[model samples]
Every structure is written in C-alpha cells, then in structure tokens.
Target: MDSQPPSTPPSQKHGQTGNHSRSHLTPEEQRRIEVNRLKAKAIREQREAEEAKRIPHPSPTRGTNIGTGVKRSFASMSSPQGPATLRDGRTGAIHTNRPLDSIRPARNFAKYVEYDFSKMTDTKGGFLTEDDDPYNKALYVRDGKKEQKPAHMTQKEWDRHQLLKSTRRDDIMVSGSKQNTCCECGSLEIDRKWEEAFGCCVCSSCKEKYPEKYSLLTKTEAKEDYLLTDPELKDEELLPRLEKPNPHKATWNNMMLFLRYQVEEYAFSAKKWGSPEALDAEFVKRESEKKRRREAKFRSKLQDLKKRTRVEAYRRNRNGPAGGNFGDDLGSGSRHVHQWGRAQENPEIGMDIKKCVDCGMEVEELEF
Candidate 1:
C-alpha cells in the first residue's frame, strides 16, 4: 500500500460524470433513472407556474408601492391601464381596487337641498313665508278640496241620491215582482220568501202554522217532482211507479240461511260440516291441547333438571371428599373436621352439609 495508492475509478474521480457513472447499470435501469429525472423537472416547472399565478401584478403607475399605504392621485387611481390596486391598511395585503359605483353613494342627497316654499300656497290660497313659519315646523297640506252636499236638500232626496250613488246599475232590477208558490201548501200567493233557507217560498199562513216543516217539506216535494218527471216514463204519465226494496238490504240471518241451502245442494261439500261457532270452538280446543303439551314438556324438563341435580349431589357424597390431603391441611382440614363432627352429632347438620369432590371443602346444601 505504501508503494502506490489505489487509483480512483474514472466514474468516481469526477462528481459531474452523472449518467456516465451509471454506465455500469443495465439499459432498463438507465431508462428508469432518465424518466425519474424528467418527472422531477416537470414537477418543479409546474410549481413555478402555480407560484407565478399567485403573485400579484406590479402597479403600472410610478410612485405606487403596492403593499405600502401611500395615497395616489385620483387620475392614476382611476386609470384602467392595468387593474387598479390598493393596500389594505390593516392587513397590508394588496388588493384590486373597486370602482366608485361599487361603493354605496351618499343616501337621500336631495334631502339636503332646501325646498322652495315661496311659490307654494296654503289651503287658504296664501303664499308661505319663511318668517311666518319656522324651518322645523310641520305643515300638513291637503291635496284637493272636497265638494260638500247642499244643506237645503230634503231628507228623502238626500237618501235617494245616496242610494243611487252607492248602488251599481248592474245590480238593480227594473222588472215587476213575480208570483212565487208556497213550498208547503202549493199556494201561488207566497207572502214571505226565505231566500237564505234554501230559497224556499212559503206563504205567511203556512209559515206561521209550521215554520220548521217548510224546508223539510220543500225538499221532499222537490224530490217527488224529480221522481214524477223520470225520463224512463212517457210524458203522458205524470207519476212514476214505486220501486221495490233493495235486495242488498237483506239481514245477516237471511244470508246464513241462503248459504246453508247452497251448501246442501252443492255436490263437493263436506259430509260432516259444523256451524261457524262450532268450528271456532274446535279450533280453540286444538290450540288448548297444543298449549297443554308445551306446558307438560316444560314441567318434564324442570323435573329432569331437579333429578339430575339430586343425582349429582348423591354421587358427590358417595365419592367422599376431594384433594389428597383432605384431613392433613390444617387450615381447611380443621374447618371440615369441625363441620363433620357437628354433622355426626346432629342429624339436621348432616342434612345441610355438602362436600366438594375436588377441593374437599364442606359447603351448605343449596335449596331450590
């Protein structure tokens, strides 16, 4: 190594070799590197374009520093050589200026101009003077004069004139009154016309005799009149014949009797058929039997569970206690020995005592 330092490779000697250093790579690797380089370059150019779109345009007029709050001439501000610009006083951001019309103009400009009251006159036809009225004084001006009715006219004349003026000619009738027939008594001399009560024409005598029956009798008489003039009958026949009762009005009992007869005559009917009530009772009985069976199954399951528990208890007792050192572990053994001694002494304690087959711990029996 002291004789000569290892010569650096041509590819490593110069850092500017770029793709030349990659010459040792396969053609596919070389192509992939070139594609990646082009993609990075395209991305950089796209970012530059987006930045350019975000940057604000420089003001055309001189002496205007876009984001600086400096007032400029009105002419320069209004000029459309480029978009007008303004500096936000608070935020310091440059924004495109709005036109004069975009801002709200002074409201009620005409209100400031004093009205000329010299040419105006009062209701008495006198000219208004500034000295006579204060500037803050309010003046109520009626638009026109109203014509007053003559006081010399008679009451009847006044009433007739008012009625004629208020009434429209189209609503007035000039013909004589026509005779109306009484709805109740069929009299042509109907003294009172009840227009609100279904437009009935009832004679005074009939109305006095039966006021409530007038409308009812009128409606019935109209219905009779309509029936008498039926289109199905000839004009020579003034009245129509009575119609039979509707068959659809038959009672439930009649329908049941008809159905019974039809079933008796039908060929495919069942030989032993019961009434609806009897059939309903039979269905109820079958459902009751099904419910009883379900209850019996539930009872059987409960009994079986109880029997299994009793058998488990008996087997546990027959197998003796659990744990190899049942009577040797002083801690648990002492407690069990005490319980066992007591059980032997008292028959009731034996009935209540139970022992675990695995742990040999004496536990009290659980009563269901």
Candidate 2:
C-alpha cells in the first residue's frame, strides 16, 4: 500500500493562503498596499522615537514598548487610591472599616442611615441615652504637647499612659555611679570598662599596679587555674562574668571573661574551698589521685601484655644425641631432672607445694 502525501499544518496552510482577496490583487495594487503599510509602520516608529526623546529614560533599557527604562511593577501601574469599604458579599452587611463610607454618595438619606435594634428600639432593650456612650470626655486625653494620649481614653488609661512614659529609659537615669577620681591613685580619669563592669573606679596605671587582682582571665584559664566547675562559672551573680564574642568562631557561644582576683576569691571562699591553703591541698590531692590512676593504668596494660603473650614450656635438651650442653645433664645419655625447692604448706588446698629451681615449675603433693 502507498503512503498518503504529507499533510500541511493548519498554521502553515493559513500562512501560505492568507487573505484570498489580497492574494488575487494585481502587482500595482499589492505594491500600493505594501507602501501604505510601510508608511503606517514608519509613522508609528517615529512617534515612539519622539516620545522616547521627550521623556528621559534610565540607562540600559527594559523594553522599547515602555517609556520608563526600569521595569514597572503591577502596583506601580495602578493609580494611587485611598482605602474604600464595600458591603460583604456573603452577609450583605456594610464593611466594618468604614460603615458610612460603604454607602454610595447620593441625594437619598435613607440609604446611608443605619439602625441598631438593641439601642435605638424602645421594645427589646431600651432607648439609648448619652450616659450609654462608651467614650468619656476628651479633656484629660493630653498631658503636654508631645505627651498627648490617644483620643477617647479613660482616666485610668491616661494614668497608665503617663506611668509608662515616666518609666522610659530616656527619662530615667541609667547610671548615676559617678566617681571621677581613681580609687588607687589620685588620677582624675578612670578606666571606663573597669568601672562600669568590674566596679573598679581605678585608672589603667592602678590596674597595672595590681596585676594579680585586675588581670583578665579567659574561661579556660579560670577553670584550670582556679579549679572552678561549669556550674560555678555559669553563676552570674557569684562570678559576674563579662561576655565577649568568641575570637576563634563567630557562631560559637560567647567567651566569658573574669578578673584573676575575683576567680581566686570565689575559688578560695568559705563556701567553696575556704582558703588558698585549702585550694592548694585540694590541688595536690587531685594531682596525687591523677598520678595513682596513671600508675594503675600502666600496671593493667602490663598485665594485659602478659596475658596475651604465649609462654613456652621449659625443655632441657639432653646429651643423649651428643648435641645438648654437657652441663645440662646430671649423668651421660639422660635428660636433666628437676631440682625441687623446700616444701611450703598450701593450707587452702591441703597440699605441700614445691617449685623447680631451673624451670620455675610448681608441684602440689597431698599429705595425710
């Protein structure tokens, strides 16, 4: 069977046989029509070019279709409109945001007028009066020009507003700890950081004068040198640590800083270790304990080594074949016999134990 001829696509067919009336036109008519189309295109392009020149555009364009070179968002394209309220489609009630605004502006007053049966009607509840109004008088709503409270607030609300204002950080004194003179020397200026955090109103020179007290210690140093625990270090009230960003890692927990003297004081306090002498005693004890543990571990390792190693049986080769040591045999042509040691009573087994001098082998003999 023969295959049918390849079918042309609808788009291709439409394109090839476009406008049957136009296709039947003479060459002169077609030329005139094409000239008109070209003229129209030219005029459109000229108008667009003029518009582009008249309105300045940003550099590096978005598209030629838009006058503004920058891409315009959908929100920017729409006109700026104030908020408007319309009736809810589900309830057919006026929107809560603007109850009066939802109604269309008209000459009819009845459309805008709304009523609440609970307040306005004289049957169900009662006729509403000025006493039924929720809002109070708007007189004391403001204290001062800037301290003005929001409108329609109660006396209690206005009092709360003033109370909150009084407690503001700007109004309250943050720090009144003024000490101009240094505690150690008679210097006028003291170290800002030391006085603020460490409660030391001393100059940098005085801080250097007493290195043992004022010297800063790292968290690790404090723990190792002072023998303080994690819980003790974490106690802010007790230790009063100064936190700083970790120098090694930005993401890690902040590094805690403490004065050497403070750490020493806490470590040697009555609640802690009592005194430096007591701290020294504890330190020594820990060191001795650590040494003991090391020795025990070493001894254990040695025992393990002994257990893992295979012990060879003691064999004394005889001169029976004339290939053994001459002194190894007690007599010619014979294997050497084991020389036993003095007998010791083994009370647990009720046996007399004897060991050979050469091979270190033991023998157990029961006696009546």
Candidate 3:
C-alpha cells in the first residue's frame, strides 16, 4: 500500500486555499475583492480616530510617575525651616520668615510727618484756627448730660411725685383685675350665672327687683318686649340688627337696647302689612309648621340611608372570603343573622377549608 500524504491542518488548508482560489478569479471578482479590502481598511482607521478623540490629554504638572522618566513642570517646595532665602523684588532687600510685629524699619526711615495747616480755611473763608481759643476748649455737651432729679428736691414736690406714681400703679392694678361692680349698689359682688348666660354682670338684688327686664331673659323675650313698646318696625331691618350682637361690649343695658331696636323695627314693618300683633302670630305659626315638616323629611331620609349602607356592607361580606368578615357581628337586624347562617351551612362556598395549624381543626383559610 502507498503511504498516505500527511494530513493538512484545517486552518492552514482553508487560508491558503482561499487566497489561491481568489487569485484565479475574473477581473470583475478581482475588483470586488479590492473594493472590499479598501472598505475594511477605512472602517478600521475611522474606529481608531474615534478612540484617539475619546482619550484625554495628559496634564503638564501632573505627568507620568517618577520611574517612567517623566518630569513635572514645577517642583512642590515645603515652607523654609528658618529665615527665608528670598528677596523682595521691588525693594531689593532680603526678606525673612519672621512675624510682622518683629520686623524693624531701616534707621533712615522717617518717624513722623507733619501736615501744613497754614493754608486751611473754613467754608466761610475764615481761618480754621480763628475760632479756636485756649479758654474755649471743645465740650461734650450731650455725652455727660442726663435726666437727673433736682439736687435739692422740696418735701412738697417729692410728696406729689410719690402720690402720682402710687395713683398710676393703683389704676393699672384695678384695670387689670377686670372686676365688674354693680351699677345699682356700687358692690363688687358678681352674679356668675347671669354673666355667663347674658355676657353681662348684674347683682342678684337688681335682677330680682326687675324680673321682666334683667331676669336672664332670652333674646326672643327681649325682642317681644321691644315689639310691644314700638309697634311700627319692619322685619327686614330688625333681623340684621338682632343678629349682630357685640359680645365684647355686651352689657345688660346694651343687649336690651339692641333687642328693643329689633322689635321696634319688626313691629313697624308688620303694621304696614296688617295688624302688627296678628301678623307676628301668623308668621310664627307658619315658621313652626315648616320646621316640623323639614325635620320629618330629614328623619325619613336618614333612616333610608342607614338601611342602604347596611345592605351594601352585608352584600360585600357575603361575597368575600369568610375569614375577612371580622366585623360581621357588628351589623344589626336579621340580615346579619341570615348571612352568618348561610356561611355556616356551606363553609367552603366563600373560602378555602384548611386544617388549623395550632388546633388541627377544619377551619376556613384566607388565600393571600
């Protein structure tokens, strides 16, 4: 048998064969190959240019490491240990690293300089020194001046001053106390109940004496009294005046005056419409009837709303998992009972049934 030729390696065989095969191609093929070669070369050069642009330039001072033979532009020098070996450029003198206070001037330097005052003059064309005199030196008129008591105060003056100060102090104390005195008896005693209700103070004795006037009367009663006294007022004007009671300045007298004004105004308007007393009675009756109807309607709507809310809550709990119905017992009526009964009859209808981990009983389990 003839010895087989040595097998060619896969890489070398394909490379060499490809080159040789391309070389024997037609003119068109050769041109195509050349064009492809140039395209690849251009692409490589373009990539190289982009990479070079992305790199940053090296700093002059912060050059390559010392071992790389690269040198820095300037050397970093530490502070000198003793007197500086530098000199001042302008003065051409040696400069030392001593504290500023320790530096001494040259012997030839002048110690003092004098200013010429002979040519100086005031704004009025008078010599500046013409007003100066040895006997008339500048005096600090305001600096030493202070408000001081007379060196010798008379006994009468002292007594008057003390009396004025004591009176001022007493007035301040009285105002700050905010205590009300009864106008009738000039007594400091206050009726707290009357004050709280009417926002005004009146002594018990006065209130007892004038029952109809000061006996903790309601705003309505006061208004009626005012209307009885002045029966020619209008409601349009009266209502606004009655509504705006000044609580801060509200004394018994002030409140009564306001009520009286409201009633008088209402009566005047009522008289224009008809008999003042008859019109007032009719108005009261109509308002009371309207109020009753409104309250009844509100109650009916409130009940319906509460029922609808309960029905919605019941529906939600019935459809959801049994374990999440934690508040089912909080609802009222047979609806809640019926839901509980349904849940018990079909335990697996709304939730998964699982064994309890602790008690090992068949219990409803929630799926997360």
Best by lDDT: 2
Compose the digit string of candidate 3's lDDT tens values, residues 1-368: 84756665645666898889877899998889899999998887667555544554343334432335733221111324232234344454443345565566677764532435554444476433423422322321334453233424566866775676566446545753566667567566656534433354568787677655453333545445433333222232433222334455644233333333234444456444345576577668877999999999999999999999998777556656444333335434554322222213344386755442222245564658
Q: In candidate 2, which residue pairs get closer than 3 Å at backbone N, Cα or C atoms, i.e. clash? A: none
- Report lDDT (Cα) of residue 47, candidate 1: 74
Model 2, CA-based lDDT = 0.65
lDDT by residue (139-174, candidate 2, tens digit) is 233435545544446779789757764554343344
Per-residue CA lDDT of model 1 for 1-368, tens digit only, reads 45655675644546557767666789999799899999998887667655645665585454645567844444444445433455434444455454564554468663454455654545476555445544633443434562334444567866775676444233335332444457678775554214222345667787568744532322123233222122322221222122223345743221111111222222123322345455456557777999999999999999999998997577556555543334444332234433332222227554566544344556565457
Clashes of each: 0, 0, 8
Q: Candidates' TM-scores? A: 0.17, 0.38, 0.21
Candidate 3: give the clashing pairs.
232-268, 233-265, 233-266, 233-267, 233-268, 233-269, 234-265, 234-269
TM-score of 2: 0.38
Which candidate order results from sorting by lDDT in descending order?
A: 2, 3, 1
| Candidate 2 weakest ten by summed lDDT | 312-321
- Candidate of highest TM-score: 2
